[model samples]
Target: MWVDRADWNCCGEPFRIGSQVTWELRRDIDVRWLMEALGSDTAVSVDAFQYHHGDTDVASEQTSGTVARIRAVHWRSAPQTGTVPGSGVLTELNEADRGAPDRGDLTFEGFLVTLKQ
Candidate 1:
């Protein structure tokens, strides 16, 4: 499931293996040397930063960029959560479900993304 914690959550559309996606950076990221390091057509894995949760330090609009190519696909799975192995499945909690006491430990998903400026 998506990164659902007291700190942040996912608020964007779900992506697929070949989907082009864009997201904001949690902090300043230096990708100036990416093309040189991985070549123009090469796709590299990077983190899809967390969604803002009203924390002034982790705002959603910090840094955003153009859509980037999905170089390859990798799935994140957990046996307990019964997630599809290598599917990278993530869930976004509805506002009402944010702090439900019945909600116990939840699985989280991480993304490796490329950034296009």
Candidate 2:
């Protein structure tokens, strides 16, 4: 679902929900911020500033073959009510949250990109 600005004009269909996407990193962003956005049910928007190299605008420099962008989408999940609404049956939760298997070893690689406005 990653569309460069140059290709955006050619796209006919609108972006839909639940579509996972990845794009370049236009500006510096914190990984925590991205994680928070993903966890939330609302859409978060941020502005992207055009970079400059010497007297030339880096964003318009497609000749260098380097353009930065970010990947993100608005996600919605069923509300967490702790149990089924009608039925009285309880739902099982993730084992990781219960400290079953210690898979806490997590690492994030690559730069955290943000969606450009």
Candidate 3:
């Protein structure tokens, strides 16, 4: 999960930089593959960005026209079972940047946190 400093009400919590915000993967893309494809300092298309209310399990709210920045990429697994079910990455974005021109194209800034399950 992640939080937007400007859209605290949307998240239903106080604004905190780098906070976790709920995200939904629209496609079945490998996190490692996506990280490699994006590389470092490369802009990525925000078309894949889908946001939702943090308090709900069902994806009923969708935030459109936003940008994303890849923060980190790592693999996660259950140490006890040695089962690697999924991986996650963090991304950051500005609430004001939403609906801006070219918002649907690519983004070079903001924060992000992504999880693949």
Best candidate according to TM-score:
1
- Name the runs in model 2 displaced over 4 angstroms: 1-7, 10-14, 28-45, 49-117
Please say which candidate is ahead in TM-score: 1 or 3: 1
Ranking by lDDT: 1, 3, 2
Worst 10 residues of 3 by lDDT: 99-108
Give the worst 10-residue stretch by lDDT in candidate 1: 94-103
Candidate 1 achieves a global lDDT of 0.36
lDDT of 1 by residue, 1-117 (tens): 112334332354544434444544454334333333333342233333445445566545544444343222223334665444233322332222232232133333233344455
Report the number of backbone clashes for model 2: 1
| Model 2, residue 12: C-alpha shift (Å) | 9.0
Candidate 1 Cα errors over 4 Å, as ranges: 1-10, 14-22, 28-48, 58-61, 71-108
Clashes of 1: 4
TM-score of each: 0.33, 0.19, 0.22
lDDT of 1 at 105: 37
